[model samples]
Target: MRTSSGAGELLVELNRDSGVPLHQQLESGIRTRIRAGLLRAETVMPSTRALAQNLGLSRGVVVEAYQQLVAEGYLVSRAGGKTQVADIAVVEPTIAAPAASGPPRIDFRYSRPDVSEFPRAAWLRSVRRVLNETPYRSLAYIDGRGTIELRTALSDYLNRVRGTAARPENMLICNGFAQGSRLLLQVLAAQGRTRLAVEDPSDNDLRDVAQAAGLEVVGVPMLETGIDVAALEQSGADVVLVTAAHQFPTGAVASAETRAALVAWATARDGLVIEDDYDAEYRYDREPIGAMQGLAPDRVAYAGTASKTLAPGLRLGWLILPSWLVEPMAQAKLMDDRGSPVFDQLAFADFVARGEFDRHLRRMRPRYRILRDTLVDRLAARIPELEPVGVSAGLHVMTWLPPDLGEDALREAALQRGLGVYGLAPYWVAGDGPAGLVFGYGSLRRKEVVEGIDLLADAIATIRG
Candidate 1:
């Protein structure tokens, strides 16, 4: 019999002496292969004549086998005289039973915005406008920093909204905040700056980024106001990363006094400040705070991203660097990815220029504010002991748990009741802090937010009892 080993070939052995009919044996073999997932859906089967010739059988036997499998729904006959496996539903193998079951139904993870509210219509219009207006030359490999049009638009926007000292020549568009941070760290390492200081209780992923670049990461203590500028100065690091507007997880705004102290510290030590202006657009109580880069533009490298305002999947972020670091940062970006995609940058520029971006933010801020208020109100009314702190700004609020309860235990209990609550233990890099939970209200609706907090309170009560 003609036999060949290939990805699509099926191996079959038929015995004329056996009591089983040739057609029945072929069908059984094909059925077993399908059930075992060896033959996947839509995989083409060898033609009847070819299979019969290869197996030294009559064409009628092969045809009968094929017709039987077709009737059983394991195979399908397609147009243009082709036979292929049908889209049959197969039972997957259950590897093992889980000890604790699946994840919670309601998630309260931090730093995520309401993606369902993304402005699809406005974005599509902007994309079409950019594609129509863009020159052919702009599509080729050009500036490593980004399209000049996008940089100019960002310059105007940052200056007007955040009070930043931005210039098109000094801005570089990056993949996201993570990539931008990596590029900055690489540039600093090149300059023989080996130490990087970050705010304690900050995002662990950011500290890992610095460590990945072979730089020593030191944690500076966070105060009630913001990062303790006094401790940061003593850290003796050449570069420090700060979230001045709304600190992650804590939602603490850096005070004017603290901002001035940080700027002066950078000036005195000739150190560099990397300002991550993440989520500064979603302030509820008062006017949003301006960027710290306005105070000392030459020393601070201001970074912003569309992850909070739009979506994280876009991977769009920018850095407004000091005049001296422009070439170095751009060079690092060149070696990293040869700059971010140009089309998205152009589309974002069009979106900002047409005022669609600001309009979207205006529409979203009130909804987020109401959600924030609802979360705080529901938690306070349901569980008086679980006090919600940092309620004025950002997408999340930190609540201090009771001194008697452990944060991890409470989180696990909440998860069991289909409620996801995050503990603050992972945020701290050093010494222990009070037990707390972080609730992100951005993705949860008003009713869901209320119900979630009630369930969380019930979980805590059961744990205490």
Candidate 2:
């Protein structure tokens, strides 16, 4: 006899082919699990009727097994007529020794927001209001497309803020950008769309996602103005994913001509465009760029997340879909996780509608700008070899290194000195490209930024020697 589980907690297996009695087998299986600590002390045991129903045995067999276990002190009957594990003296597990570590390293990787800035008060207020006023039925299992309140609020907010003309019915709330992208890409792949084109040096996580969705990810070269439209057209890819508002790594906003051409390309080829408007909220110098989905709503899908604005642990994201893609995306979402937690969706909706979200962004924008400026200035002053690019907006800054300064060696040296620096080599998906480093300043203080740059400069000097 052995004990296992399937979906539920426990499964009891008994060999009827053996001459042993059924009740004895049942008793041995459960006893074996309890003694082995798989079923620990004080754990509630299943009722005899339920156990018998589950194991396809008579109530008498289950009752007999329970009685024997009770007699042996493996289980105890509580006042409420429930059976629970007795106090069995199990051997204590050994604890592992703690490993020593060095000083805390300053991390410059992108998207690490200063969680200290999260508006706990505002969030608590929204959540409290949701818990108090939202109907019990509304709190129950919701549609995969998300609640009407959140979608409506998002529709209004995106249109007013992101230049997107989204409708509530076409939106689906998801567990951040990763799951949203997976749901969309898997649906497209299932529809026989085989190729996904991304910028040559794009966020590699998107590549991993597309591949997992069974789509062939194609890499198109990225130009200063944005994605190379000509190369994208020639790549034989039916779908394209781009950070249109501000391209990652390069921070290149698509030129007006390129944006128009991309829409045309999608329209003419009947291909789809996936606009990753990930961190478009934190523009420092210029006004926020509008999303491409507005130009061709039917031909493009928009994905946005709270990961950048709020904490990533929230795992909150949304997708504004085209009318034609709504059904499939909703079905995908239902099959994926039914829907995201209603509490978050409800709270976020309240956050947006109450204007708390705007206030928080208003407060964070200047702080992030100051950090980005400090990073740029430090890199420019400390090491003239590093040329800061993509400083117009977002939480991070990218700096190009002179060809002679080997990126790999500098990063390794920096890591040795309690510094975390990211290089562009891993971002590139094709032919060799120029060397550069990406510094994420969102989570760092002005002092940390200054210190990190000095350390990077020292690493460069060491590599130069």
Error of 1 at 21 (Å): 23
lDDT of 1: 0.87
lDDT of 2 by residue, 69-147 (tens): 8998887888877787777623234568665755447999888888999999999999999999999899677888999
Misplaced by over 4 Å in model 2 are 1-104
Best by TM-score: 1
Q: What would the TM-score be for candidate 2 when compared with the true structure?
A: 0.81
For candidate 1, what is the TM-score? 0.83
Off by over 4 Å in 1: 1-85, 88-100
